[model samples]
Target: MVYVNNVGQAIMQVDRWTTLAPGQARNSVRIESYAVFNKGLFILDVEAAPWGCGVWPAWWTVGPNWPWGGEIDILEGVHDNVHNAMTFHTQPGCSLPTPNPKTSLGPNSTGWIESTDCNAFANSNSGCQTVDTSQASYGTQFNVLKGGVFAMMWADDGIRIWFFHRAAIPEDLQENAPQPNNWGTPVAFLHNTLCPTSKIFYDHQMIFDITFCGDWAGTSYISSGCPGTCSQRVMTPSNFANASWTINSLQVYRSPQISGASLALPRPRSLMYLSAGLILLLLYI
Candidate 1:
């Protein structure tokens, strides 16, 4: 889960997400998979943004079983979510196409597409979502304009997400060499001909979490009005003190057409289940 707090000399991989203070039944902090990807380009420069009223933060990508090694939530929403959806759970022969679901956008997309069957439970689970027209991009107005830039461009031939706000991020990803074709429009897009993005995606890993009531803030807490459940406002501790998640930097840029890993290929994690948050890049071109 990549959390080397007080290591001595050189390990350096800290996410420092905190929680478990306020009340007590809900706890927080979750960093799954240090780094693991089968594609390329995954960036996150969140400085701070996880609003209150029973928060349920997330950053996703999955593999290791469950839905046949596929699941990408990107950045979820909960509580008083003002925007930011981007989902994709899978298993049943992959799917897409809803409210203009196509790929390779770069003209500064606003983002739409509610759900178009990314399987997981077929329609009811409502995977395959995409909605982020920048209502500050999500929560507390995206931490008041201080946090932005989340780009994920996995490639077999499709999967793109771009959101740059902290002064319009793009300049080769602030000089880190992340081109992403000029970083224009792509609030979300999924292609690879609908399925077979390497047999429904694989080897994902990379997740940041802040759990609370559970299953999406106790099943949506009556759409954030707060009636009951969600374990009673997570055991009520001043309603989570504005939640947490304040990451400042993260970068994974690989894909000069594949490098040292030689072509990250491997399957059969016995039937994986811990799944996606996508961060294990070595995808050479």
Candidate 2:
């Protein structure tokens, strides 16, 4: 996938990859690649994201079963809101706490709930949760009009993530790793029984890209309240025209490391001599 701004261009491309059509929405796209499932890695870098009510910009991954398979939401939020959330969609056993203390779910609080129990907010949407930012700690203190980085890593054990502000991106991440901080804070979402086998659990590849507006952010009545959808509440035509979710670039590398050993045949004489020596030793014995 590729995005071009008036200044230049940003591209998201992968070998042996698949792209899905926009789903029931105007500004969204989906890309899939089972090849990277248990082999390599996938990285996404979003440029400037659109902020408005009914606007959903996401970078996430899912497994076979819906709630059972597990969902990892790297970056997801309504436009112009301060708190962008990192969530995991899983079975009953893997629910996360509201206002995650470890990651500082924050001061102003909208609590957490189980996937099966979030029905009150489900006005027809499948997986819906209400998070109030002014009440939450993170967004309450800052201005979210500007875009940032969001990222996730699906590995052998569990998912790991990091969210960085544009200025806070580590030098190492900027030079070597894809910069997720530019979009938002990175968080890992996990699911129970998503991977029945240990071999396949952490083996699947991850994808990174941006969706304009869809299920989560584009929900009906999203622009009503104080901590309502960011896109609906915050975006202006001027900013929407000038600002956009821009992806700089993406790169994938084997964690630990990829073996570099080469396979070559031994010289015939070397093999023959070794074999003859073994035969002579056997005879002597």
**lDDT values for all models:** 0.65, 0.39
Name the runs in model 2 displaced over 4 angstroms.
Answer: 5-8, 11-28, 33-35, 39-43, 97-146, 177-215, 218-244, 256-285
Top lDDT: which candidate number?
1
lDDT of 2 by residue, 49-152 (tens): 43444344555666664554555555556545556555555444433334454534422223232232212223342442323233221232222423334444
lDDT of 1: 0.65
Best by TM-score: 2
Error of 1 at 93 (Å): 1.6
Residue by residue across 1-285, what tens digits does model 1's lDDT show? 222123211111212233444445554566566556887667877756566655778788898897778888888788878788888888887766546336422233457776667888776667777788678787887878777879887776667777888898877667656656565557877776676767788899877776665666767777778766566566655666556655555666555463211323122112122111222222111
After superposition, candidate 1 runs with Cα above 4 Å error: 1-39, 43-53, 60-71, 74-87, 90-92, 95-123, 126-195, 198-215, 218-237, 252-256, 259-285
Positional deviation of residue 212's Cα in model 1 after best superposition, in angstroms: 10
Any idea what lDDT model 2 has? 0.39
